[model samples]
Target: DKMKNKLNKQPYNTVLRREYNNLRNRITTLTRAARDDYYSEEFEINKNKPYKLWKLLNEAACRSNKKQNKEFPIEKWIDEKGKKMCTKDIANKLNNFFVNVGSELANKTQSRNPRAPTTRQRDSMFLCPITEKEVMEICKTLKINTASGIDNISASTIKNN
Candidate 1:
C-alpha cells in the first residue's frame, strides 16, 4: 500500500511540474513577441517622418513649372543606374534637399491671398430685388417693419399694370 501511494504521488508531481513549465514558456514567448511588435511599430513611425517630408517636397516640385533637375536637389540623389531606391532612402535624401530649397523658395515666393472673402465683402452683396420684395411683403404682413412700413409694390406687379 505504501509503494502504491508513493507511485501515485510521483505522477501527480511530474504532471504539475510540466504544467508550470509550459505556462512559463508561453508567457516568455508572449512577452518577447509584444516587445518585438512595439519596437517594430516605433521604427516604422520614425521611418515615415522623412518619407512624408519627401512626398511633400515632390508635390511642391510638381506644382512648380520648373524642371525637377534644374529646380530641386532631389534629382541629384537619383542613382545613375536609374533604378529607384526605397522610400526610406529617397525620403532621407529629399528631406535634405528640401532643407536647402525651402529657404530659397520661401524668400522668392509671395504669400498667398486668403481664400475666403472678408466680412465687408460678404456683407456687400445683398439679396436680389425679386426675392427682397417677397421678403418685404411677409414683413409688412407681420407688422415687423413699423418705421418706413413695407413697400407692397413689386417689379412684376408694376410691369403687368
Candidate 2:
C-alpha cells in the first residue's frame, strides 16, 4: 500500500521514490549479509558438530518433492565368471550362494551336538531380575534424541516419570 501510494502520487515525487528505493536496497543487502554472517559464525563454532545438526534439514529435504542428490541405479552386476547379470540373475546368484553356505553351516552344527544348548538357553540360565534403580539409570543414560524403542516409550518420557 505504501509503495502503491508512493507510485500513485500526483506530483510524482522522484526524490521520495529514489530515497525509499535506496533505503530498501540497503536494507536488503544488510539483512542478507547479517544472515550470512550469523550462519558462518554458527558453523565455525560447531565445525565438529555431528549429523544431528543437519537432521531436521535432511528430514525436510526428504519430505520435499524436489530430489536433492540422486544416485545412479545399478542395472547389472559382473560375476566371477565375467557374466553381466541382470537384477533377477543377481538375486538368483545370491540365493544360491546363501543356500550353499547355509547348508554347510547347518550340516556342521547338526554334526556337533543335536542337543547343544543355544545362546538363548545360556543367557536365560544366568538371567536375574532388574532393580527399579537399574532401570531408571539405564533410561537416564539413553540419548534423548533417539526415537521410542520397540515398546513405544521414549527415553524422555521414562526420565520424566
RMSD of 1: 25.8
lDDT (10s digit) by residue, model 1, range 49-144:
886555555554556535565553443465558865666788887788988897888899986875785566655767655787786665455433
List, in order, the clash count of every candidate structure: 0, 0
lDDT of 2 by residue, 105-148 (tens): 87777554568666564545556889989988887888878899
RMSD values, in order shown: 25.8, 23.2
Q: Give the clashing residue pairs of candidate 2, or none.
A: none
Worst window of 10 by summed lDDT in candidate 1: 140-149
Q: Estimate TM-scores for all models.
A: 0.23, 0.30
The weakest ten consecutive residues by lDDT in model 2 span 52-61
TM-score of 2: 0.30
Residue pairs that clash (backbone atoms under 3 angstroms), model 1: none
User: Using lDDT as the measure, which candidate wins?
Assistant: 2
> TM-score for model 1?
0.23
